[model samples]
Target: MLAPSQAHILVIDDTPEAIRPLLLALRGRHWRVSVATDARQGQQRAQLLAPDLILLDVRMPGMDGFALCRLLQASPRTRDIPVLFLTSAGAADERLEGLSQGGVDYIMKTCEPAELLARVQIHLQLARRRAAAVDDTPAPPLSPDEVVLRAAMRLIGQQLAELPPLEAIAARVGTHDKKLSAIFRRHLGMTVFAWVREERLRRGRELLADPLLSMQEIAGSVGFRSACNFTTAFRERMGVTPSQYRKGLQDGAAGKGTPAG
Candidate 1:
């Protein structure tokens, strides 16, 4: 149980100077605040600080807020922390996208300080209440295989655009390729490369579901080197090209109902 004054907040933004007032306002409540300027640093800081709440910027170099949010959700250590998205863009699609990506709130960067602080306070209080409601008993520890899988998946997710070799990935997770292969085979029912292919297609499908994204942008985002390659692979896997699938999605949405993502 933490006191109100003991609550910690992490602010992940590329331009900290732009959000100086928000930082001051947060500290005014006597809460601990930490800042990270980019997605990688933000991830490291979140894991280290285990902050009660996270204020994430929508745009950043390397990885965007959505990607970082997904990474956090995939990790056991930091998944439960509430994330509030701060963006200069107030477009309906952007707000909907943020919420769909598991954000608790999508706040405009230009919002009044008082309103922002009020929202922050609400989430903080809710977090405390949820924590109190959880059982005190500790959950069972993860096995070695589970730990490796999580770490490997996290690494792969972060570097999807330029994934390292299998041996390198295995080494990073403190295991050799053979053991890592066995672990993936046993738990995921596939080889590491096979899983990577499936993950790329999965993420690509997700990007395709968004009507606002272009084919080239979607291709690059999910680690495909070129739109042509993405199309080829997508066609091979889904029995249709990315364009066809997206058209089907839009047509379905227009005719009947919301398409399943």
Candidate 2:
């Protein structure tokens, strides 16, 4: 792992006994480590702290870790935080679920303290590099396939309501999926799917400015499967519910019409 001089980490586990060895291992390592005893608190802390990495236990009371990880992925505020599963569940399906839910690594709690800390440090370092590259200022230069890129953007925007696959977008852009993915990543600093999601959320924000539109209509208009899904996605991306965003717009409009009172 990279130098741990200034990195911050969060551990979400139900068992206090399980956390002891980790705290011991991380002691004197100069990391800002915080713990949450359950998923709900873990989520709140994640949004507020924006820690670089999270060590989440798979099994917990109330919401389990898989669901919690999905919640993290849905929220734009904490979406990028790398989650390493501090779990004892060893089934292949369980591991698959963890990774699918956006966990970066899965480590059993029965392991030695050194192994635990080592995995934690490695993931934290990887996440640091990723955020650094993705958020780089003065983004990388565009490629010469300007025409194709324009075509692709137009296709995505036009079909956002349907939310077609990247392959479809590539096909419509007169290219293959691999090349399209490369171009998107090279020009946009993100994968094609990620950029599509970002664009959808951005467009959703614009649509939220219209008070006439219902949440279901807006969700459908932006290619979300349902209103509930849209709410989660919007909350994740904007750090607020869609209704709240619309209300803020209404509030701002009212403030503007107050006639300087």
Candidate 3:
């Protein structure tokens, strides 16, 4: 049996073609792996399996990546799991959006497989260290910056589905809207709206992986009012519609034969 500290990772992506190499690479390293194609199921798996880490894709049909990240961060059961976003969006602005949405790190889809694996290892190590510190320092308080960031992250994560306007988030964080925008730009390197859109796309991808939910239902659950709107946004960010993404996931699963339950 693999050691627990070897770390189990759940890869959540609507693009099965992109995920295949990542799955093979992590398994080769002797890390147990679980795959979820959509955000809702991914969230369910994270709660049930409590994987040590989550490898998340930023775009999908329904909830998108950022929304899923927020849900994970808000839920006590899964909040501590480290999330690393795997995305095709490699611009500096996109990277900042991913980080601001609660990702520990972001990996571009164009990254070499070896580099991706190395980054995963680094994130797992850091996660373990942070967990240890929390265990050892039971009474320690967060620094001012840490406190502010955590609070902001928590609110953002919870609201990713409903996604409040920038002014609302700024008010909650006890800052002027302009100051909040500047803070996100300065520290996270992206505008607040861009970060929110990235996160929504992330959660939508996760939701698209579920077979039980209809496209319309998934869209509504993830804050989209209509399937047309969801599909358009998904394609804009991910370069495919929800139906195509779902088909790819099904095809990949069929090719893999039976997966471990």
Candidate 4:
């Protein structure tokens, strides 16, 4: 497990106010956090600090989130750092775009503070687990299949936000749709569409934990066409409505509060 104090977070966003609340929220959780206002600076900081995780904004004046994600993934020095997209665009297409660009996750600006913290914790946990596995390997070699899978996964993650038809992805991979689907099922243990939905929900859950974003914003950010649809899907996957889930988390936190006396 990654200790809260040892966990380093790099937050990339252009808005100063947006950065403040996020920093404050993470600080409250005892996380060591770094802030960067643009992709260029963020990249530089990432090289220097090698943060455990990166929270990148989707839209910017130049060199947007997608470009930055590709750059990071291409660099041998920084490819291992997990990236999560923080953006105002929540359309299915937009979410898919972020994922396909090599981001580990996506988050809407309308997320609750607490929910945001929980996601940070979860990703950090995953990163630590992955790091442990790497440490155990003396000189692990990448297989050709892994290379292909990584490429395909990157494409899938980036394009999901657009909700591209299955055929398009298959075409990009130079394979038939049915064949690609079978490959996904064999390797990832799920259909391509199912993987897309799962990725969307995973991002949605992270957004739901943040108090800063509204339910509607979260809905849009995670690719649901409307709040109603988002809520329904969320309920289906999580066994609770978005509002209810947030309430439950709040209630749990309250229950764990130290006594005032």
Candidate 5:
């Protein structure tokens, strides 16, 4: 359980000047504070810190707070942290969206410093209580299959460019190759290698949407050693070369009077 003074809060806001008052108020309470200026950085910080509370800006560049909140909910590590939406606009629809996206509270940036502090304290207390209850009645441990699946998936995602051999991956996740293959087939409807291939193509497709990345860079990123191999695989699965798919995307965007990039 987090004491009032021991609370660690993360403030995710792109506009530092606008959030200065909130920062000062939070600091004055003797609660530890961390800041992340963008949604990507905020997500990384949230997972790393697992702070007592999160004060997330509703609007951010690239991914908005709502999208970031959804990501947090998807992760097992940061899902329990309380998220308070910080906004200057205070629109009704925005508030509803924030709440629907799993925020615990919505606070106006223009609110009184004392009021903000009070709200922060309330949420922190609630988080502490929840933690205490969970401690009293602990959650069940993850099953072996679930643990292996999560670990293998995370490892593959982090090392797409140089994934280990199938036996090596299974060994790392504390299972043999045959058992791992069976697990993948049971849960993912495919063998481990097939899943990895699909994952690589999926990642490649996402990179293809970025106009700045060359085909070679995208190929290297998603585990293909050369652009030729990537193009062949992509064409076999997608019925078009990666370049053609990208051109289609650009063309579609151009037809709608929008820049593809």
Candidate 6:
């Protein structure tokens, strides 16, 4: 297995100026970086090197990033490599198409070098961890509907203190509330209310694990009207009080490190 720091990174972009900074960014981090000026050569390089990750641009001469992504997915040699699209396209549908075609994530071209490097490192670590755990198991690409659902879920996660109404979230994701409802029911077998409540409790549990936050603060953060309401909802989902759960986790972690007798 290639070490994450030494992993090969292939950048496929038609423009020389766009490629320069990206090359500088990854090579500076001690990664082995390769460049292809067009999608055809990029595809060839991808097959020959079987790179650890790919940074693809959307616009190229013959095959754009979206088309090349399909080709990559079709080939066993490059199917599992993570691809992050770097393009100026910011439309929701464009993002949905990119995710549907098997790209790991989409990034804007104008983003700072630091942000790009951080995203690259993060995905590389995740891919390495996944490869170590699984036997090159291919992940099913998300459908356009699933992409929208994910966008909605992300909005909810970000605004837990005051979640927008379902209508607002649907609008943000470029769908109607009724359509979002049907999509959720079809894919998740749950209504929006159920998903939201579960997400709140889930976040509450994570916040409780942090010793610095008070119960009242965690409660307000997760959208509960009061600490009592938060505790009641938490107990219902976790089958224990939040306080008990926190202490149990700390105790378990402490015991987990003790040497065997």
lDDT of 1 by residue, 83-192 (tens): 99987867899888678767899998898888889998889888888889987554444564775687678778767888889987776555678998999999999999
lDDT of 5 by residue, 31-77 (tens): 99999998879978987787989999977766677757766654667
Candidate 2 per-residue lDDT, tens place, 36-119, comes to 999879977987787878889887877678757766764656767889998888889999878865788888888888898788
The alpha-carbon lDDT assigned to residue 194 of candidate 6 equals 90
Instruction: Pick out the ten consecutive residues of candidate 6 with the lowest summed lDDT.
Output: 136-145
- For each candidate in turn, the TM-score is 0.58, 0.51, 0.53, 0.52, 0.54, 0.51
Better of 2 and 4 by TM-score: 4
Off by over 4 Å in 1: 136-261
Instruction: Put down candidate 4 lDDT per residue, 57-88, tens digits, no spaces.
Output: 87775557775676677455577889999788
lDDT score of residue 33 within candidate 1: 90
**Candidate 4: lDDT of 146?**
40
lDDT (Cα, 0-100) at 8 in candidate 2: 84
Residue-level lDDT of model 3, residues 11-71, one tens digit each, is 9988767657867888989888898988778877987798988988877776677767766
Locate the minimum summed-lDDT window of 10 residues in model 1.
136-145
Candidate scoring better on TM-score of 4 and 6: 4
Off by over 4 Å in 3: 1-5, 136-261
lDDT of each: 0.83, 0.78, 0.76, 0.76, 0.83, 0.83
Q: Who is ahead in TM-score, 1 or 3?
A: 1
> Which number leads on TM-score?
1
Any residue pairs clashing in model 2, and if so which? 75-236, 76-236, 76-237
Which stretches of candidate 4 lie above 4 Å from their native place? Answer: 136-261
Task: List the lowest-lDDT window of 10 residues for candidate 2.
Answer: 135-144
